[model samples]
Structures are given as structure tokens and as C-alpha cells.
Target: MALNENEVLAGLAEIVAEETGIEADQVQMDKSFTDALDIDSLSMMTIVTLAEEKFDVRIPDEDVKDLLTVGDAVKYITKAQA
Candidate 1:
């Protein structure tokens, strides 16, 4: 089943929080994963791997580079689900 936008966002925030120790509530749409969350590339890759397992979506490495913000991830996962 495809998750809605809010559901994707919530799940993604949880994944980010678990991986980086950032509060889920702090994972807002406009926040940049690197600049705002201070997530390094290794952390980002781990987060991506976990998110792929949780969301059952394949986020290619090339595509990942384009997903800069929280909203970008949420939208990509949501679309991938569909």
C-alpha cells in the first residue's frame, strides 16, 4: 500500500531521528538533511538504507544526490510507493 505524504514524512522523520539522534519533530520539510541536520555522508547513506527497508522503496544513489531536503525525501518515497 502506498503511504500518504504525511505518513511518509512521519516515517522518514523517525528513520532520520533513529539514525542521527535528531528529534523527529525537528525533521521539517524545509530543513536540509546535510546543512540543517548536520548529517554526514555516511549517516545519510545509513539513513537511506534504513528508509529503503522501512518504506520498501529503491532510492538510487544518483537520485539520492538530488534529494536535499526532508520534503524531497518524503515526496520521493511517496511517489515511489505509488
Candidate 2:
């Protein structure tokens, strides 16, 4: 099955919110995960793992650099599904 961007955004928001202790409603697409969520590389790796498990998409460590914002993740996940 293909991944849904809306679903990805919602799930990613929940994941980030849970991991960062932030309100999910406050997670915007343009927000920088590092600056906004204050997540480190380890946390990012955890997020990547969670995304892989949830969306069944492969997010290489090298690709993690491209996922600076929530929108980038959404785009990558959707593209990976295709």
C-alpha cells in the first residue's frame, strides 16, 4: 500500500510531539526538527526508525540530512512509497 502524506504528517507530528514533550498541534510543516523540537542525531535516528516501521520506507542516514523540516519528511516518505 502507498503511504499518505496527511497520515505521515499526523503520525510524524505525534511522534515528534511525544518524543519532545510538545503539543502535536504546534508541529508545523516548516518547523525545523532540530531547532523546533530540539532533537539530536540520536533522536533523529529514533525518528527515522519509527518512520520506517510506520511507513515502511527506507530513510538512509545520509538522507536524514535532507529531512530538516517536517515537510521534507512528508515529501520523502511519499516519494519513497512511489
TM-score leader: 1
The sequence of per-residue lDDT tens digits that candidate 1 reaches over residues 1-82 is 9999899999999999898899999999999999999999999999999999999999999999999999999999999999
TM-score of every model? 0.97, 0.89
Say what the RMSD of model 1 is: 0.6
| Candidate with the greatest lDDT versus the true structure | 1
lDDT of 1 at 28: 94
Candidate 2 — what's its lDDT?
0.85
In model 2, residue pairs whose N, Cα or C atoms come closer than 3 Å (at least 3 residues apart or on different chains), thus clashing, are: none
Report residue 58 deviation for candidate 1 (angstroms).
0.4
Q: What is the Cα-based lDDT of residue 77 in candidate 1?
A: 93
lDDT of 2 by residue, 8-73 (tens): 899988887777777888777888888986789888888889988888889988999989998999
